[model samples]
Target: MERKRDYMTVQELTENEKYKFWYFKIKECKESGLSVKDFCDKNNIKPSTYYNYQQKIRNILC
Candidate 1:
């Protein structure tokens, strides 16, 4: 029999963890040299989520 897998909710991640997660994602996007949509499509990440986080991080920095 196969067992189920558990996943943590976004609420469970600390603010710093969330920052690091998005930071890496943005860095990966830059290094990949692919358009945001293309990179997100290849990684199976929601493009909206990527854009939202990018804006959030910018806001935090400013």
Candidate 2:
């Protein structure tokens, strides 16, 4: 039997990784035109967590 991939959780992100996480996410969204659910499915992230990140990025930009 094959095991599912062990995905990283949002809480495990180091302070420095925040920039990288957001950058890649925005790039993927902008370039691929993927919805949050689609992007999360492709990247193995949870929707709620992705929402939190989106808010964070919005805060940073504003």
Candidate 3:
């Protein structure tokens, strides 16, 4: 059986795609009842990098 991927490296995505990707990830993390560090660890993302993307998303919205 083939497994599907739920994540992609930011470099493989276009600029807008990257934003949306991280935005959804942040949202998913928030709704998963997991702390940011735990979520990042489970997802293979660095906590600092996740926080940076979260800040970037917020800056875009604000």
Q: lDDT tens string, model 1, 1-62? A: 97765965567567779888998899899999999999999999999999999998888889
Please give the TM-score that candidate 1 achieves against the real structure.
Answer: 0.73
Question: Considering every candidate listed, which one attains the maximal lDDT?
Answer: 3
- Distance from true position, residue 18, model 1, in Å? 1.0
Give the 10-residue window scoring lowest on summed lDDT in candidate 1.
Answer: 4-13
Candidate 2 vs candidate 3: the lDDT winner is: 3
All candidates: TM-score: 0.73, 0.62, 0.77
Give stretches of model 3 more than 4 Å off: 1-13
Record all residue pairs in model 2 with backbone atoms less than 3 Å apart, i.e. clashing: none
lDDT of 3: 0.93
- Whichever of 2 and 3 has more TM-score, that candidate is 3
Minimal lDDT window, size 10, model 2: 7-16
List model 2 lDDT by residue over 15-41, tens digit each: 549767776787677688888789889
RMSD of each: 10.4, 12.4, 11.2
In order, the Cα lDDT scores of the candidates are: 0.90, 0.77, 0.93
Error of 3 at 57 (Å): 0.3
Candidate 3: lDDT of 45? 98
